[model samples]
Target: MHAFVHEGNELIYKNLNDPVIEKGKVIIALRAAGLNHRDLNIPSRRGENSIPLVLGSDGAGVIEQVGEGVKELTIGDEVIINPGLGWEKNSDAPPKGFEILGMPDNGTFAEKIVIDAKQVEKKPDHLNWDEAGVLALPALTGYRTLFTKAQVKKGDTIFIPGAGSGVATYLIQFAKAAGAKVIVTSRSKEKLGKAKEIGADLAIDTHEDWESLLRNETIDIVIDSVGRATFNRSLSVLKKGGKMITFGSTTDDEITINIRQFFYGQYQLFGSTMGSTEEFKEMLDFISKHQIKPVVDHVFPLNNTQAAFDYLRAGKQFGKVAISINR
Candidate 1:
């Protein structure tokens, strides 16, 4: 079997033995995989090891084999693999320090890989392999923030800073489905136009005098992934006692805060990561029922993953980047 391994600072395509299926695990014939920024940041365990770690986080494929005690799934079943499988255990009673998949363990970038049966779920018929491959991580992250952390509701006005990334893209669609008015911001007029095409009610240029453009205005919720670059703006736009959800720090993480904004303003700020499997399932069903689809920027072969990584690193994407692993 051939897999992409991370060697120190680079990834190499090399031959490796097929991973044996363990009890309660399943072997998936990966049809496709999706790349996220995390895949590029994991430090190699061995400084100069030749066998680079697998570099994919999300994928979907057919089941080739199932391990003992795995009754819910069988060989030949098509499934979407959820990378954040431990969220159930973590949410019930989290450990002192919990780590996500694709970091210490092997990941989904290979032709074949084995994982616990709990890590996968049947792929929704509404989604193609490429769509299923990219759905799990970003949808789960968005679901947790919108429903669990921020508790977004109908008639709520949610402001999202940056409308092109995966999380923000999902937030825009999901917020609209929930009957909330979504206001999006992007630096590019063309990107903001795309945001409107995708259902954003109002799209503003972050570089413009947005504060003045929205003078004396406030929103019920603000979801910001561009941390340092837009944190102050997010704080300034929220109505008194409103909430803001912070997820990835795509922009620089550090920012100066006015402590008075927290006290006198009575605002709530919540940080979120990936959500539980229940939330993942809920999102899948929501997409199926609502016909909400993720905006896929492009699809590449598994062999060309570096290009996808480069695209994401360059930050020019308006949606998720998927790697087709099946054919």
Candidate 2:
């Protein structure tokens, strides 16, 4: 088997021994894999003596082998891999021993990967391999953030900054499907236009004065992932008593807020990350019901995964970037 691995401060495409099937797990011959910003950070996180690890979180593939004690799944089932591990049900936060895929465990970057059968869900019929492959991690994050945390409802006005990310795109689609009025911001005019095409009611340039431009708009919820760079501006546009949910801090994490103003507004703020298994199932059902397909920005062959990482790092994508493995 071949995989893109992080070894001694660099990523290399190389051959690796095939993963052995374990009890309660299944080996999937991956057809496609999705690229996330975290994939670019893994190499830096590893120490000089760290072992080589496969690099991917989102994947879609066919079941090639089923291990003992796994009864619900069978060979040849097309499935999407859930990257979240150990948190089984909906909760305020992930439980202890929780972790994401693609790090300690071998992930979906290779032609074959062995994962717990519970982590595999049937791929929605409406999605192709690429769409299904890129759908799990980001979609789950968006679902938990918008519906579970914010409790967004019909007619609510939602503001999303940094509209070009995979999670942001899913947030736009999910909010719109639930009858919310969606607004997005991006420094790039091209990304703003794409957001409008995908159901955002308004797309604004990030450089603009957000408070002045949205003075009349009642932003019921602000879903922020860009963090320090856009946090204050996003909060300024929200109506009193509104909600603000954050899942990622792409720019910088630390930010100082006005404690008095925050308390005076009676605003609700929540932090979220990758969702639980129940939420992942609910998200699949939701997208299936809405017939929503993931927005795939580009597809690269498995061996060219380094290039895919480069594309994502340069902030050149408007949606999820994918890697074609067996396909």
The number of the candidate with the highest lDDT is: 2
Tell me the spans in candidate 1 whose CA falls farther than 4 Å from its real position. Answer: 43-51, 89-97
* Per-candidate TM-score against the hidden true structure: 0.95, 0.99
Lowest-sum lDDT 10-residue window in model 2: 42-51
Per-model C-alpha RMSD = 1.9, 0.8
* Error of model 2, residue 109, in angstroms: 0.7
> What is the TM-score (0 to 1) of candidate 2?
0.99
Per-residue CA lDDT of model 2 for 198-259, tens digit only, reads 99999999999999899989999999999899998899899999999999999889999998
lDDT of 1: 0.83
Task: State the lDDT at 75 in candidate 1.
Answer: 92
Per-residue lDDT for 33-134 in model 1, tens only? 878877767643446755468767788899999999999998999998888845654262334454556766788888998998988889989888888888
Q: Which 10 successive residues of model 1 have the least lDDT summed?
A: 89-98
